[model samples]
Target: MDWNDRFAASGPGEPGPPSVLVGREDLVPTTGRALDVACGRGTVAVWLAQRGLVVDALDAAPAGLALGRAAADAAAVTVHWIEADLDEGLPVTGGYDVVVCQRFRDPALYPALAGVLAPGGLLVVTVLSVVGDAGGRFRAEPGELRGAFADLDVLVDEEGGGEAHLVARLD
Candidate 1:
Protein backbone atom coordinates (compact mmCIF):
# COMPACT_ATOMS: atom_id res chain seq x y z
CA MET A 1 0.00 0.00 0.00
CA ASP A 2 1.07 3.56 -0.49
CA TRP A 3 2.51 5.30 2.56
CA ASN A 4 -0.25 7.88 2.67
CA ASP A 5 -2.96 5.25 2.76
CA ARG A 6 -1.02 3.03 5.11
CA PHE A 7 -0.34 5.84 7.56
CA ALA A 8 -3.94 7.01 7.36
CA ALA A 9 -5.15 3.55 8.27
CA SER A 10 -2.92 3.30 11.31
CA GLY A 11 -4.27 4.37 14.69
CA PRO A 12 -2.80 7.06 16.82
CA GLY A 13 -0.45 6.08 19.63
CA GLU A 14 2.64 7.27 21.42
CA PRO A 15 5.28 5.51 19.32
CA GLY A 16 8.09 6.90 21.52
CA PRO A 17 11.79 7.00 20.60
CA PRO A 18 13.82 4.65 18.46
CA SER A 19 14.78 1.49 20.34
CA VAL A 20 18.50 1.97 19.67
CA LEU A 21 18.45 5.35 21.39
CA VAL A 22 16.13 4.67 24.28
CA GLY A 23 18.65 4.31 27.12
CA ARG A 24 21.61 5.81 25.29
CA GLU A 25 20.55 9.39 25.60
CA ASP A 26 23.96 10.51 26.78
CA LEU A 27 25.45 9.63 23.43
CA VAL A 28 23.57 12.43 21.77
CA PRO A 29 23.91 16.14 22.35
CA THR A 30 20.81 17.40 24.10
CA THR A 31 20.83 20.77 22.41
CA GLY A 32 21.47 21.00 18.68
CA ARG A 33 19.86 20.86 15.28
CA ALA A 34 18.48 17.39 14.67
CA LEU A 35 16.84 15.71 11.71
CA ASP A 36 14.68 12.61 11.72
CA VAL A 37 14.56 11.12 8.24
CA ALA A 38 11.41 9.19 7.37
CA CYS A 39 10.03 10.28 10.72
CA GLY A 40 6.69 8.51 10.68
CA ARG A 41 4.26 9.98 13.18
CA GLY A 42 7.05 12.10 14.66
CA THR A 43 7.81 9.92 17.67
CA VAL A 44 11.57 10.47 17.77
CA ALA A 45 11.23 14.03 16.60
CA VAL A 46 8.98 15.04 19.46
CA TRP A 47 11.15 13.13 21.88
CA LEU A 48 14.23 14.97 20.67
CA ALA A 49 12.43 18.31 20.82
CA GLN A 50 11.45 17.62 24.41
CA ARG A 51 15.10 17.03 25.13
CA GLY A 52 15.96 20.56 23.85
CA LEU A 53 17.00 19.81 20.25
CA VAL A 54 15.49 21.71 17.40
CA VAL A 55 14.08 18.86 15.36
CA ASP A 56 13.03 18.61 11.75
CA ALA A 57 10.92 15.57 10.99
CA LEU A 58 10.66 14.49 7.34
CA ASP A 59 8.18 12.10 5.77
CA ALA A 60 6.55 11.74 2.39
CA ALA A 61 3.11 10.91 3.68
CA PRO A 62 0.84 13.79 4.63
CA ALA A 63 -1.24 11.51 6.80
CA GLY A 64 1.83 10.58 8.77
CA LEU A 65 2.81 14.22 9.07
CA ALA A 66 -0.66 15.08 10.33
CA LEU A 67 -0.53 12.37 12.93
CA GLY A 68 2.96 13.53 13.89
CA ARG A 69 1.77 17.09 14.27
CA ALA A 70 -1.00 16.02 16.60
CA ALA A 71 1.33 13.86 18.60
CA ALA A 72 3.85 16.67 18.97
CA ASP A 73 1.10 19.01 20.14
CA ALA A 74 -0.13 16.48 22.69
CA ALA A 75 3.42 16.07 23.93
CA ALA A 76 3.74 19.84 24.30
CA VAL A 77 6.76 19.99 22.04
CA THR A 78 7.49 21.54 18.66
CA VAL A 79 9.05 20.04 15.55
CA HIS A 80 9.37 21.17 11.98
CA TRP A 81 7.41 18.70 9.87
CA ILE A 82 8.76 18.40 6.32
CA GLU A 83 7.04 16.57 3.49
CA ALA A 84 9.42 15.22 0.88
CA ASP A 85 10.17 12.05 -1.01
CA LEU A 86 13.45 10.71 0.28
CA ASP A 87 14.03 8.79 -2.94
CA GLU A 88 14.64 12.10 -4.62
CA GLY A 89 17.30 12.88 -2.02
CA LEU A 90 17.50 14.78 1.28
CA PRO A 91 15.59 18.01 1.07
CA VAL A 92 17.89 20.00 3.31
CA THR A 93 21.65 20.08 3.52
CA GLY A 94 24.31 20.48 6.22
CA GLY A 95 24.61 21.84 9.78
CA TYR A 96 22.69 19.11 11.54
CA ASP A 97 24.30 17.94 14.77
CA VAL A 98 22.24 14.74 14.89
CA VAL A 99 20.76 12.80 11.95
CA VAL A 100 18.54 9.79 12.54
CA CYS A 101 17.26 7.34 9.93
CA GLN A 102 15.51 4.41 11.56
CA ARG A 103 13.78 1.49 9.87
CA PHE A 104 14.35 3.10 6.53
CA ARG A 105 16.92 1.72 4.16
CA ASP A 106 18.13 3.49 1.06
CA PRO A 107 21.75 2.87 0.23
CA ALA A 108 21.69 5.61 -2.38
CA LEU A 109 20.98 8.19 0.29
CA TYR A 110 23.66 7.08 2.70
CA PRO A 111 26.17 9.60 1.42
CA ALA A 112 23.64 12.41 1.63
CA LEU A 113 22.89 11.49 5.22
CA ALA A 114 26.57 11.62 6.17
CA GLY A 115 27.06 14.82 4.22
CA VAL A 116 24.25 16.54 6.06
CA LEU A 117 25.95 16.16 9.41
CA ALA A 118 28.21 18.86 10.80
CA PRO A 119 31.73 17.96 11.89
CA GLY A 120 31.66 15.93 15.10
CA GLY A 121 27.95 15.32 14.52
CA LEU A 122 26.32 12.04 15.43
CA LEU A 123 24.54 9.64 13.05
CA VAL A 124 22.12 6.94 14.08
CA VAL A 125 20.76 4.44 11.56
CA THR A 126 18.86 1.18 11.68
CA VAL A 127 17.84 -1.06 8.79
CA LEU A 128 16.66 -4.55 8.06
CA SER A 129 19.50 -6.95 7.38
CA VAL A 130 20.11 -10.49 6.17
CA VAL A 131 22.18 -11.57 9.15
CA GLY A 132 20.70 -14.53 11.02
CA ASP A 133 17.66 -14.48 8.78
CA ALA A 134 16.48 -15.20 5.30
CA GLY A 135 17.87 -12.75 2.80
CA GLY A 136 15.46 -10.46 1.04
CA ARG A 137 15.59 -7.64 -1.49
CA PHE A 138 15.04 -5.08 1.25
CA ARG A 139 17.57 -6.40 3.74
CA ALA A 140 21.13 -5.22 3.96
CA GLU A 141 23.90 -7.74 3.54
CA PRO A 142 26.20 -8.43 6.50
CA GLY A 143 28.70 -5.62 7.19
CA GLU A 144 26.73 -3.24 4.99
CA LEU A 145 26.32 -0.56 7.60
CA ARG A 146 29.84 -0.94 8.87
CA GLY A 147 31.38 -0.69 5.43
CA ALA A 148 29.12 2.11 4.23
CA PHE A 149 29.91 4.22 7.29
CA ALA A 150 33.53 3.27 7.67
CA ASP A 151 34.63 6.86 7.18
CA LEU A 152 32.98 7.86 10.44
CA ASP A 153 34.21 6.98 13.91
CA VAL A 154 31.81 4.18 14.65
CA LEU A 155 30.53 4.07 18.20
CA VAL A 156 28.09 1.19 17.69
CA ASP A 157 27.82 -1.29 14.88
CA GLU A 158 25.70 -4.40 15.29
CA GLU A 159 24.00 -6.84 12.95
CA GLY A 160 21.91 -9.84 13.94
CA GLY A 161 18.37 -11.16 14.03
CA GLY A 162 17.57 -9.65 10.66
CA GLU A 163 18.59 -6.15 11.69
CA ALA A 164 21.56 -3.83 11.39
CA HIS A 165 22.20 -0.74 13.47
CA LEU A 166 24.94 1.86 13.49
CA VAL A 167 25.80 4.86 15.58
CA ALA A 168 28.77 6.89 14.45
CA ARG A 169 30.31 10.30 14.81
CA LEU A 170 32.06 12.33 12.11
CA ASP A 171 35.51 13.59 12.96
Candidate 2:
Protein backbone atom coordinates (compact mmCIF):
# COMPACT_ATOMS: atom_id res chain seq x y z
CA MET A 1 0.00 0.00 0.00
CA ASP A 2 1.00 3.62 -0.49
CA TRP A 3 2.29 5.52 2.56
CA ASN A 4 -0.69 7.89 2.66
CA ASP A 5 -3.23 5.13 2.58
CA ARG A 6 -1.30 3.11 5.14
CA PHE A 7 -1.04 5.98 7.58
CA ALA A 8 -4.66 6.96 7.02
CA ALA A 9 -5.70 3.58 8.32
CA SER A 10 -3.49 3.83 11.39
CA GLY A 11 -3.69 5.79 14.62
CA PRO A 12 -1.21 8.23 16.09
CA GLY A 13 0.54 6.16 18.68
CA GLU A 14 2.92 7.24 21.40
CA PRO A 15 6.26 8.55 20.29
CA GLY A 16 9.25 6.50 21.23
CA PRO A 17 12.99 6.94 20.94
CA PRO A 18 14.42 5.86 17.63
CA SER A 19 15.35 2.19 17.48
CA VAL A 20 19.10 2.86 17.39
CA LEU A 21 18.74 5.05 20.47
CA VAL A 22 16.72 2.70 22.59
CA GLY A 23 19.37 2.23 25.29
CA ARG A 24 21.65 5.07 24.30
CA GLU A 25 19.49 8.12 24.81
CA ASP A 26 22.37 9.81 26.62
CA LEU A 27 23.97 10.54 23.26
CA VAL A 28 21.30 13.13 22.54
CA PRO A 29 21.87 16.74 23.53
CA THR A 30 19.06 18.47 25.37
CA THR A 31 19.48 21.70 23.45
CA GLY A 32 19.77 22.67 19.79
CA ARG A 33 18.05 21.61 16.62
CA ALA A 34 17.05 18.13 15.47
CA LEU A 35 15.78 16.75 12.22
CA ASP A 36 13.97 13.49 11.64
CA VAL A 37 13.97 12.69 7.95
CA ALA A 38 11.29 10.38 6.68
CA CYS A 39 9.67 10.80 10.04
CA GLY A 40 6.81 8.43 9.69
CA ARG A 41 4.12 9.36 12.20
CA GLY A 42 6.59 11.84 13.75
CA THR A 43 7.52 9.47 16.48
CA VAL A 44 11.16 10.49 16.64
CA ALA A 45 10.26 14.14 16.18
CA VAL A 46 7.94 14.23 19.18
CA TRP A 47 10.39 12.20 21.18
CA LEU A 48 13.16 14.67 20.37
CA ALA A 49 10.98 17.63 21.30
CA GLN A 50 10.17 15.99 24.60
CA ARG A 51 13.90 15.93 25.20
CA GLY A 52 13.97 19.74 24.88
CA LEU A 53 15.30 20.02 21.37
CA VAL A 54 13.81 22.12 18.61
CA VAL A 55 12.62 19.45 16.21
CA ASP A 56 11.63 19.39 12.56
CA ALA A 57 10.23 16.19 11.12
CA LEU A 58 9.39 15.61 7.48
CA ASP A 59 7.63 12.95 5.46
CA ALA A 60 5.86 12.79 2.13
CA ALA A 61 2.53 11.55 3.45
CA PRO A 62 0.06 14.08 4.81
CA ALA A 63 -1.85 11.36 6.57
CA GLY A 64 1.34 10.29 8.31
CA LEU A 65 2.02 13.87 9.27
CA ALA A 66 -1.50 14.22 10.66
CA LEU A 67 -0.96 11.16 12.80
CA GLY A 68 2.36 12.61 13.87
CA ARG A 69 0.64 15.85 14.86
CA ALA A 70 -1.78 13.93 17.03
CA ALA A 71 1.09 12.08 18.64
CA ALA A 72 2.91 15.32 19.32
CA ASP A 73 -0.20 16.80 20.87
CA ALA A 74 -0.67 13.79 23.08
CA ALA A 75 2.92 14.12 24.22
CA ALA A 76 2.39 17.79 24.97
CA VAL A 77 5.44 18.74 22.95
CA THR A 78 5.79 20.91 19.88
CA VAL A 79 7.21 19.59 16.62
CA HIS A 80 7.47 21.40 13.34
CA TRP A 81 5.97 18.77 11.12
CA ILE A 82 6.66 19.25 7.43
CA GLU A 83 5.07 17.42 4.54
CA ALA A 84 7.77 17.19 1.88
CA ASP A 85 8.91 14.84 -0.80
CA LEU A 86 12.42 13.67 0.06
CA ASP A 87 12.97 12.78 -3.55
CA GLU A 88 13.15 16.52 -4.17
CA GLY A 89 15.92 16.74 -1.58
CA LEU A 90 15.90 17.93 2.02
CA PRO A 91 13.38 20.67 2.60
CA VAL A 92 15.22 22.36 5.48
CA THR A 93 18.75 23.60 5.68
CA GLY A 94 21.59 24.33 8.14
CA GLY A 95 23.38 22.20 10.66
CA TYR A 96 21.63 20.36 13.45
CA ASP A 97 22.65 18.83 16.77
CA VAL A 98 20.88 15.63 15.90
CA VAL A 99 19.81 14.01 12.62
CA VAL A 100 17.80 10.83 12.55
CA CYS A 101 16.77 8.70 9.59
CA GLN A 102 15.13 5.47 10.64
CA ARG A 103 13.72 2.70 8.48
CA PHE A 104 14.58 4.67 5.38
CA ARG A 105 17.35 4.04 2.91
CA ASP A 106 18.77 6.53 0.49
CA PRO A 107 22.44 6.12 -0.23
CA ALA A 108 22.33 9.20 -2.35
CA LEU A 109 21.46 11.29 0.67
CA TYR A 110 24.13 9.93 2.99
CA PRO A 111 26.59 12.75 2.42
CA ALA A 112 23.87 15.32 2.88
CA LEU A 113 23.17 13.81 6.27
CA ALA A 114 26.75 14.35 7.37
CA GLY A 115 26.92 17.75 5.74
CA VAL A 116 24.09 19.04 7.93
CA LEU A 117 25.62 17.97 11.22
CA ALA A 118 26.90 20.58 13.57
CA PRO A 119 30.22 19.98 15.27
CA GLY A 120 29.82 17.19 17.79
CA GLY A 121 26.46 16.39 16.33
CA LEU A 122 24.95 12.92 16.53
CA LEU A 123 23.47 10.93 13.67
CA VAL A 124 21.32 7.89 14.24
CA VAL A 125 20.14 5.67 11.44
CA THR A 126 18.52 2.28 11.06
CA VAL A 127 17.78 0.44 7.84
CA LEU A 128 16.91 -2.97 6.57
CA SER A 129 19.98 -5.09 5.84
CA VAL A 130 20.92 -8.15 3.84
CA VAL A 131 23.04 -9.59 6.64
CA GLY A 132 20.66 -12.16 8.04
CA ASP A 133 17.59 -12.16 5.89
CA ALA A 134 16.52 -12.44 2.30
CA GLY A 135 18.05 -9.53 0.47
CA GLY A 136 15.79 -6.99 -1.17
CA ARG A 137 16.27 -3.91 -3.27
CA PHE A 138 15.67 -1.70 -0.28
CA ARG A 139 18.14 -3.42 2.03
CA ALA A 140 21.67 -2.26 2.61
CA GLU A 141 24.51 -4.58 1.80
CA PRO A 142 27.28 -5.42 4.23
CA GLY A 143 29.34 -2.45 5.48
CA GLU A 144 27.12 0.04 3.69
CA LEU A 145 26.42 2.30 6.64
CA ARG A 146 29.90 2.25 8.04
CA GLY A 147 31.37 2.77 4.62
CA ALA A 148 28.95 5.51 3.77
CA PHE A 149 29.76 7.54 6.86
CA ALA A 150 33.39 6.61 7.35
CA ASP A 151 34.32 10.22 7.80
CA LEU A 152 32.31 10.42 10.98
CA ASP A 153 33.43 8.97 14.28
CA VAL A 154 31.33 5.87 14.58
CA LEU A 155 29.95 5.19 18.02
CA VAL A 156 27.89 2.18 17.15
CA ASP A 157 27.73 0.01 14.07
CA GLU A 158 26.00 -3.32 14.00
CA GLU A 159 24.27 -5.44 11.42
CA GLY A 160 22.33 -8.64 11.86
CA GLY A 161 18.92 -10.22 11.48
CA GLY A 162 18.18 -8.19 8.37
CA GLU A 163 18.74 -4.84 10.06
CA ALA A 164 21.58 -2.35 10.36
CA HIS A 165 21.99 0.43 12.90
CA LEU A 166 24.58 3.12 13.13
CA VAL A 167 25.29 5.95 15.52
CA ALA A 168 28.01 8.40 14.67
CA ARG A 169 29.31 11.66 16.01
CA LEU A 170 30.86 14.53 14.11
CA ASP A 171 34.04 15.78 15.64
Candidate 3:
Protein backbone atom coordinates (compact mmCIF):
# COMPACT_ATOMS: atom_id res chain seq x y z
CA MET A 1 0.00 0.00 0.00
CA ASP A 2 1.03 3.60 -0.52
CA TRP A 3 1.66 6.17 2.16
CA ASN A 4 -1.83 7.55 1.58
CA ASP A 5 -3.33 4.16 2.26
CA ARG A 6 -1.21 3.72 5.33
CA PHE A 7 -2.23 7.07 6.78
CA ALA A 8 -5.85 6.44 5.89
CA ALA A 9 -5.74 3.17 7.74
CA SER A 10 -4.22 4.78 10.79
CA GLY A 11 -5.82 6.92 13.44
CA PRO A 12 -3.21 8.98 15.18
CA GLY A 13 -3.48 11.54 17.92
CA GLU A 14 -3.06 15.27 17.61
CA PRO A 15 0.08 16.74 16.11
CA GLY A 16 2.93 17.52 18.46
CA PRO A 17 6.42 18.97 18.42
CA PRO A 18 9.21 17.01 16.83
CA SER A 19 10.15 14.21 19.17
CA VAL A 20 13.78 15.40 19.02
CA LEU A 21 12.75 18.77 20.38
CA VAL A 22 10.43 17.63 23.14
CA GLY A 23 12.37 18.97 26.12
CA ARG A 24 14.61 21.27 24.14
CA GLU A 25 12.07 23.50 22.46
CA ASP A 26 14.29 26.48 23.29
CA LEU A 27 16.36 25.52 20.25
CA VAL A 28 13.41 26.55 18.04
CA PRO A 29 13.03 30.20 17.11
CA THR A 30 9.55 31.48 17.82
CA THR A 31 9.08 33.96 14.98
CA GLY A 32 10.72 32.75 11.80
CA ARG A 33 9.86 30.42 8.98
CA ALA A 34 10.15 26.67 9.37
CA LEU A 35 10.08 23.76 6.96
CA ASP A 36 9.22 20.15 7.63
CA VAL A 37 10.38 17.69 5.02
CA ALA A 38 8.44 14.44 4.63
CA CYS A 39 6.05 15.97 7.06
CA GLY A 40 3.77 12.97 7.53
CA ARG A 41 0.42 13.95 8.97
CA GLY A 42 1.87 17.44 9.50
CA THR A 43 2.56 16.68 13.12
CA VAL A 44 5.72 18.67 13.63
CA ALA A 45 4.76 21.33 11.12
CA VAL A 46 1.52 22.21 12.85
CA TRP A 47 3.28 22.15 16.15
CA LEU A 48 5.84 24.65 14.85
CA ALA A 49 3.01 26.90 13.70
CA GLN A 50 1.51 26.72 17.15
CA ARG A 51 4.83 27.89 18.50
CA GLY A 52 4.53 31.08 16.41
CA LEU A 53 6.56 30.11 13.35
CA VAL A 54 5.22 30.30 9.84
CA VAL A 55 5.45 26.71 8.68
CA ASP A 56 5.70 24.84 5.40
CA ALA A 57 4.98 21.13 5.53
CA LEU A 58 5.65 18.74 2.65
CA ASP A 59 4.63 15.13 2.33
CA ALA A 60 4.00 12.54 -0.35
CA ALA A 61 0.54 11.68 0.85
CA PRO A 62 -2.50 13.88 0.43
CA ALA A 63 -4.26 11.99 3.21
CA GLY A 64 -1.48 12.90 5.56
CA LEU A 65 -1.65 16.55 4.55
CA ALA A 66 -5.38 16.53 5.17
CA LEU A 67 -4.84 15.10 8.58
CA GLY A 68 -2.36 17.86 9.34
CA ARG A 69 -4.65 20.57 8.07
CA ALA A 70 -7.35 19.34 10.36
CA ALA A 71 -5.02 19.42 13.30
CA ALA A 72 -3.88 22.92 12.38
CA ASP A 73 -7.45 24.17 12.19
CA ALA A 74 -8.21 22.53 15.50
CA ALA A 75 -5.27 24.36 17.04
CA ALA A 76 -6.18 27.64 15.35
CA VAL A 77 -2.87 27.78 13.47
CA THR A 78 -1.85 28.12 9.85
CA VAL A 79 0.51 25.85 7.95
CA HIS A 80 1.27 25.69 4.25
CA TRP A 81 0.84 22.06 3.40
CA ILE A 82 2.29 20.72 0.18
CA GLU A 83 1.98 17.24 -1.26
CA ALA A 84 5.15 16.21 -3.01
CA ASP A 85 7.71 13.46 -2.98
CA LEU A 86 11.12 14.41 -1.60
CA ASP A 87 12.91 12.07 -4.00
CA GLU A 88 12.52 14.78 -6.62
CA GLY A 89 14.27 17.34 -4.35
CA LEU A 90 13.02 19.85 -1.81
CA PRO A 91 9.96 21.56 -3.26
CA VAL A 92 10.22 24.77 -1.25
CA THR A 93 12.56 27.73 -1.54
CA GLY A 94 14.39 30.30 0.57
CA GLY A 95 15.93 29.96 3.99
CA TYR A 96 14.09 28.91 7.09
CA ASP A 97 14.85 29.57 10.71
CA VAL A 98 14.22 25.90 11.41
CA VAL A 99 14.19 22.71 9.35
CA VAL A 100 12.87 19.43 10.65
CA CYS A 101 12.88 15.98 9.07
CA GLN A 102 11.81 13.25 11.41
CA ARG A 103 11.85 9.54 10.61
CA PHE A 104 12.93 10.24 7.04
CA ARG A 105 16.40 9.46 5.74
CA ASP A 106 17.56 10.88 2.45
CA PRO A 107 21.28 11.35 2.15
CA ALA A 108 20.95 13.11 -1.19
CA LEU A 109 18.91 15.83 0.48
CA TYR A 110 21.22 16.31 3.44
CA PRO A 111 23.09 19.22 1.86
CA ALA A 112 19.82 20.84 0.89
CA LEU A 113 18.77 20.84 4.52
CA ALA A 114 21.78 22.91 5.42
CA GLY A 115 21.45 25.06 2.35
CA VAL A 116 17.92 26.00 3.36
CA LEU A 117 18.88 27.06 6.84
CA ALA A 118 19.08 30.72 7.66
CA PRO A 119 21.95 31.83 9.86
CA GLY A 120 21.64 30.41 13.34
CA GLY A 121 18.82 28.18 12.15
CA LEU A 122 18.29 24.89 13.89
CA LEU A 123 18.00 21.52 12.15
CA VAL A 124 16.40 18.53 13.79
CA VAL A 125 16.46 15.18 12.04
CA THR A 126 15.75 11.61 13.05
CA VAL A 127 16.10 8.46 10.97
CA LEU A 128 16.24 4.74 11.37
CA SER A 129 19.85 3.63 11.68
CA VAL A 130 22.13 0.61 11.88
CA VAL A 131 23.01 1.39 15.44
CA GLY A 132 21.89 -1.29 17.89
CA ASP A 133 19.84 -3.19 15.34
CA ALA A 134 20.00 -5.24 12.20
CA GLY A 135 20.63 -2.86 9.35
CA GLY A 136 18.21 -2.20 6.54
CA ARG A 137 18.51 -0.42 3.21
CA PHE A 138 16.52 2.50 4.55
CA ARG A 139 18.57 2.99 7.71
CA ALA A 140 21.43 5.42 8.08
CA GLU A 141 24.98 4.30 8.75
CA PRO A 142 27.01 5.28 11.76
CA GLY A 143 27.93 8.96 11.85
CA GLU A 144 26.04 9.49 8.61
CA LEU A 145 24.16 12.56 9.79
CA ARG A 146 27.19 14.13 11.45
CA GLY A 147 29.32 13.68 8.35
CA ALA A 148 26.62 15.01 6.03
CA PHE A 149 26.05 18.12 8.14
CA ALA A 150 29.52 18.71 9.46
CA ASP A 151 29.30 22.39 8.50
CA LEU A 152 26.71 22.94 11.22
CA ASP A 153 27.58 23.30 14.87
CA VAL A 154 26.39 20.05 16.34
CA LEU A 155 24.17 20.34 19.35
CA VAL A 156 22.85 16.80 19.72
CA ASP A 157 24.12 13.71 17.97
CA GLU A 158 22.98 10.27 19.03
CA GLU A 159 22.79 6.83 17.49
CA GLY A 160 21.41 3.78 19.23
CA GLY A 161 18.34 1.57 19.55
CA GLY A 162 17.95 1.46 15.78
CA GLU A 163 17.75 5.22 15.39
CA ALA A 164 19.95 8.22 14.72
CA HIS A 165 19.00 11.79 15.51
CA LEU A 166 20.85 15.03 15.07
CA VAL A 167 20.12 18.51 16.29
CA ALA A 168 22.41 21.23 15.05
CA ARG A 169 22.53 24.88 14.15
CA LEU A 170 24.06 26.77 11.26
CA ASP A 171 26.97 29.00 12.16
Q: lDDT scores for all predictions?
A: 0.90, 0.92, 0.90
Give each model a TM-score: 0.95, 0.97, 0.97
Residue-by-residue lDDT tens digits, candidate 2, 12-71:
767789877888899999999999999988888999999999999999999989999998
Candidate 1, number of clashes:
0
- In terms of lDDT, model 1 sits at 0.90
State which candidate has the highest lDDT.
Answer: 2
Please count the clashing residue pairs in each candidate, in the order shown.
Answer: 0, 0, 0
RMSD of each predicted structure? 1.1, 0.8, 0.9
Question: Deviation in angstroms for 95 in model 2?
Answer: 1.7
Cα lDDT tens digits for candidate 3, 70-114: 889888999999988899999887689999999989899998989
Which regions of candidate 1 fall more than 4 Å away from where they truly are?
A: none
Find the 10 residues in a row with the least total lDDT in model 3: 11-20
lDDT tens readout by residue for model 1, 1-171: 988888889955584667777788888888889999999878888888988899999999899899999988888888999999998999997999999998899999999999999999999999999998899999999999989999999998988999999999999
